[model samples]
Target: MQVLNKVTVAVKGMVQTIKYPVVWKPSLYMFLSLALSISTHEGQFYWYTNKEPPNPGFSQEFVGMVHAVGAVASMVGVLIYHKNLKDYPFRSILFFAQLLHGASGLLDLTFVLRWNLALGVPDAVFVTLEECVSRVVGRVRLMPMMVLSTKLCPPGAEGTFFALLMCIDSLGMLVAKTGGAFVLRALHVTRTDFSNLWLAVLLRNLLRLSALGAIFLVPTADQTDVLLPQDLLSSGSPAAAAGDEEERLLQLGKLTSHTDDDV
Candidate 1:
């Protein structure tokens, strides 16, 4: 998880340097891919336990197949979206996807609580779908946050900014996982208990939803420049066209330049 967080930070910082609208689209797709990867692992595990055979191999196989299929589907999605990238707002798509993802997680919790084998299959399916959707939304959530962090750093300190983001994100993940385990243990709950597991799942989804909501409060690419209209106006038409563009460029440049000067 730590390593993955680091990679995410790196990717976000790198991708923000690319063209807008275009960069935003790919980030969504990538986020969906990430979501799929995460959701599938849990789904596969659920499937294995629910099945009569309870074979770990079957779970592994299921994950592998889904991953392979996802790879192909993602490639196709990228190609299809390439032409219409700018038509969609990345944040809008991301919010919808996250809502769906949270809904799926909630459904999973419901099925677990009820111990409905009949419902379990559908729950697993929802999880699978959420996984796919997450791939797109995850990137949406991650990239914007990274871009914001990069914007706040001193000039030429992009590496430091990225490192801090990674560290914080990884720490959050570790705390979440560990805290979850502790909660379960403290409650004397077992994974097989439908009610206990469901509660845990519900809490997890709630946390995720809250996090998503928090992202909405941050200034968008456009709103970031509200603090400095004069600086933005000085940059001319291209920079003035998108406030976010000017703010991001100036912030990043200042950070990078400052770092160079410091060195």
Candidate 2:
């Protein structure tokens, strides 16, 4: 009961913290964008796994190669963002991320349309390139939100707050994947049927572009300016420390009472 009450207070405190527009706006924007970014991928995966008569098949080794290259590409994306794009305004970077992500979404369309084959590109080569580009763009899109997460952390609870932000990211990813699966199902994309995959690709790109509407949620000004109030910068919530102190005192009182009983 005591622990439950404490948890309720902590949750309420967190609710109070997020009530600030500066806090909630950007968080919501990140969550929605992350969630929506993945909604169009199921069709592509269906086409890949279910490539039948007319469609080309990707070899298992090549698929593994694509995954490996994608991991490296993600690292490169983060490095490039931190090195070159970190100083740019958050809105500008995100605007370009949306545009670039939309453009990358085109590669999916090209693959689905077999335009690469028409253009004399081998399926193996083209798909790997597409995977690398997609991973890089996705990682780049996520970087600014990560940087913002740190800036939003209150003075004292930085680690816990950042972990909470990561949990939000995970939740967004879950929603994105689930939403993507639903889109695939709605389009009747199956292991053996991917006739409508191009539509899914188009929908994904549209969704990526749609996030532009929420760009206003992110703060345009620097956190040092007005994003965080002076009081917030000065101190953080000491709830954990206070709880520890109270628990210590209670334990000490109990120990003293036990000693008296022993006497």
Candidate 3:
């Protein structure tokens, strides 16, 4: 019963989160689009590389090397975000990341066209470089998402609300995977054959680009301090706690009921 109550409260908080103009709207739309693009790209990567003309399959060693390089690149991305991007608005960081990642999807098309092979570059090297760069940017991009999700949790119900937000993210991943399978089936892409892989890459890139349209849903400033439970608890005055409780009530009321502005 206690677990059920927590789940209920968590769900209620999630509903409230959807009505939060600065958090939920952008997260919902952009997150889904990005997830779909990521899922499409990931689910198709093996087939994309294996279907290369003149070379039917990627060597396991070469794929391992590329993955090793990408792992290192991801670590570098974390350092870069900490040093260079920590001060930027979360929305701006996420926007640029999404755009850059979308542009990188075009690299898949270039691979399909065998553009680098024409320039005397080995397929292994080209794939390694592309994977490295993509991993770096992808890691940087995901940082803001976790931060924003944490920031959206309301006072007193922080644990419940944060868990609900994370569940939404996980749900997006599941949907993305399902959507990618549907696209593959729809396009008839399979391991031994990849006739329509170029179309798949294009569609994934377009979906990534489409996520940019939700930028307005991001808050312009760091607003996490607005309703911190700790702030209320640490006020050192009974009146302050009472006032905060009233404010929290009003805020939650606004969240549950449909106001014209909320709509």
Candidate 4:
């Protein structure tokens, strides 16, 4: 897990340096890759555990195949977007994708409940759905908010900003996993006990979503427009405006001196 966290942080740092628009689609694909990987793994684990002994491990193998497919898809997406990097910004794509992703999570709850009902454990469905919803709220919504927070950093600080974001996610996962295990052990409860815990978890996720929604209430940061060196020298700074005459004359004199030396 530690090694995985380091690798993810490094990738996020690299993502920070990528030019926008083209990066947007690839980043979305990357995020989906992670979400799908984690979700499928967890789903299979739960599904397998709930079954009888001598399980063939089919669910685990299936999830592994799904993750492999997601990896291939992400690679293809990157190649496809390689030429269009600056046409779309990251925030726009992230926001829209998250909205869609969140809706999908909510919609899945109905299907999950139907499956539970078919299995004659309708009560268990609520607990499973609550847990799934919490995960989706964190990954689909809060994760994007964390990424957006890094965009507020100064230009050269992008790597550090993203690294910190990754660290937070890693820590959050560790705490949630360990704490959940401890609670389950201490309570000596079976799978059915999860239903009793569903309300608390659901409320917690609601609070998390509400907090992320509040970020929209804040003002957006000023976008830094990329320009050529000549454009910067001509139009951008106070120094450029007041010393343009002297600066151009000085540059010309240096060029002439260099030419004379070359001769």
Candidate 5:
């Protein structure tokens, strides 16, 4: 009964969130990005599991190397973006990440086509490099969204609103897994039979690229005030309401600054 009640409250909260245009737009962009990337994410696992000779399943050592590279790249990306790209338009950065992510997916296709071998690149070297760059860009893509989620929450309901946004993020992953499974089965891509694997990867990359269409939904961090609803305006004097809003923004910034420090 307790769990049921909690679930009901969560459902109500989510419904309320969707009614807010500002929240829904960014949420949609995040969902689309996650859904589109599922193909590439699952494709990597399939590659490691079903690869053919000379580049068959990733050895334990290779997996460790990729992990190390990803960790280092993640740290570097976080630092650089925090210092440099933090203020850049969120949508623009996301679009750039989408392009880089597509390029990374293309690297998967290269392995599928054995282009790396044809080009005389060792499998380990190429895969490691691809993982490093792709993971870095992926980290960069997420930081802005995290910061945006924090800032987008209205006063006094931060926890519920942010959790709902994260739920959308999780929903994207769920959809991606479902979509990837469907595509893989449709393509007959089994653990051992990977003949149509390249096509599957191509499809994934295309979906990722197509997600760029939703980029416009993410507003710039600086544009938040401009996008606020007119309902927030004062009932009487415009000057007084504008002044009150400015004070609210100032308080919000202080709150965000403290939150950043905690992070």
Candidate 6:
């Protein structure tokens, strides 16, 4: 019963959070689109081991090297975001990042179609470069989202709110993976037959580009404007917000609704 009550409160908070316009659509777009876009590469790992042409695969060792390079590139991306893009507005940072994110998908396409080989680039060199760029762009695309989510947390309950944010992100990942599975099934992209894998890559790139359309949902303001809007900060709002929050806390048993206030 205690677990049930906590789940109920969490669900209620999630609903309230989603309904809150200052955070809803932007959060939805950011989390869902990025995850879904990445999921397009699902099963590609196995495809990399298949020994076929035009749809040919890389050796295990080469793939491992590519992954290592990509992992290092991801760390580099974090440093770049911290040092360079940390001060930028969420909208501006997301705009360029999404653009770069979508563009980076082209490297996937290039690999899938063996265009890199046609252009005289060795597979090892090309794949490593592609992996590195993708990781960096992905990190850049995601950092602003993490920063924004943190800023949206309410005072004194940041841990709770951040956990909810993580749940929301996890939900997006679930949906994306499910969607990618369906797409792969529909395209008949099996481990043994990856001829249609290029199509999947193309479609994924398009979806990544589409994330830009939803950018308008993101707020273009300071953290203060986002956490508690101007109206909420007005003279008359504190008592109401505090009372409402206090009542909510009591119901959740943090303040214990059954307890005497005077005591």
Best by TM-score: 2
lDDT of 3 by residue, 20-102 (tens): 56556656854675566646654456654564565327766767777898999999989988888877886678789889989
Cα lDDT over the full model 3: 0.69
TM-scores vs. true structure, each candidate: 0.50, 0.87, 0.77, 0.40, 0.77, 0.82
CA lDDT of each prediction against the hidden true structure? 0.46, 0.78, 0.69, 0.41, 0.74, 0.76
Task: Compose the digit string of candidate 1's lDDT tens values, residues 78-187.
Answer: 54444433234545545554565566565446444444444445444644554455444444444434444444332333465446545555555566556666655654
Q: How would the candidate models be sorted by TM-score, starting from the highest?
A: 2, 6, 3, 5, 1, 4
Poorest 10 consecutive residues by lDDT, candidate 4? 33-42
Name the better of 2 and 3 by lDDT.
Answer: 2
How many residue-pair clashes does candidate 4 contain?
2
User: Which residue ranges in model 5 land beyond 4 Å of their true spot?
Assistant: 1-14, 40-46, 49-54, 221-263
lDDT of 2: 0.78
Query: Comparing candidate 3 with candidate 6, which one achieves the higher TM-score?
Result: 6
2 or 4: which has the higher lDDT? 2
* Candidate 1 accuracy as lDDT: 0.46
Ranking, lDDT, top scorer first: 2, 6, 5, 3, 1, 4
* Residue-by-residue lDDT tens digits, candidate 5, 1-263: 54564455555545654577786798889888988776544545656755467445787677777879889989988998888887677777788878777777888889778899899998788888877777788888888778777765644345766787898899998999899888988998776677788898899889989989988898865623444344422242222333345557768989999999999
Estimate the Cα RMSD of every predicted model relative to the unseen true structure: 11.5, 3.0, 9.7, 12.1, 10.4, 4.6
- What lDDT score goes with residue 111 in model 2? 88
Per-model clash counts, in order, read: 17, 0, 0, 2, 0, 1
Instruction: Locate the minimum summed-lDDT window of 10 residues in model 1.
Output: 32-41
Worst 10 residues of 5 by lDDT: 232-241
Model 6 pairs whose backbones collide: 52-56
Encode model 2's per-residue lDDT on 1-263: one tens digit a residue: 66875666566556656677787888888888888776665456556655475576766566777899999999999998878888777778887887898889999899889999889998888988999998989888888888888877666556766777788888998998888888888888877788888888888888888888999998886423436566566555443444455578778989999999999
Better of 1 and 2 by lDDT: 2
Error of 2 at 132 (Å): 1.3
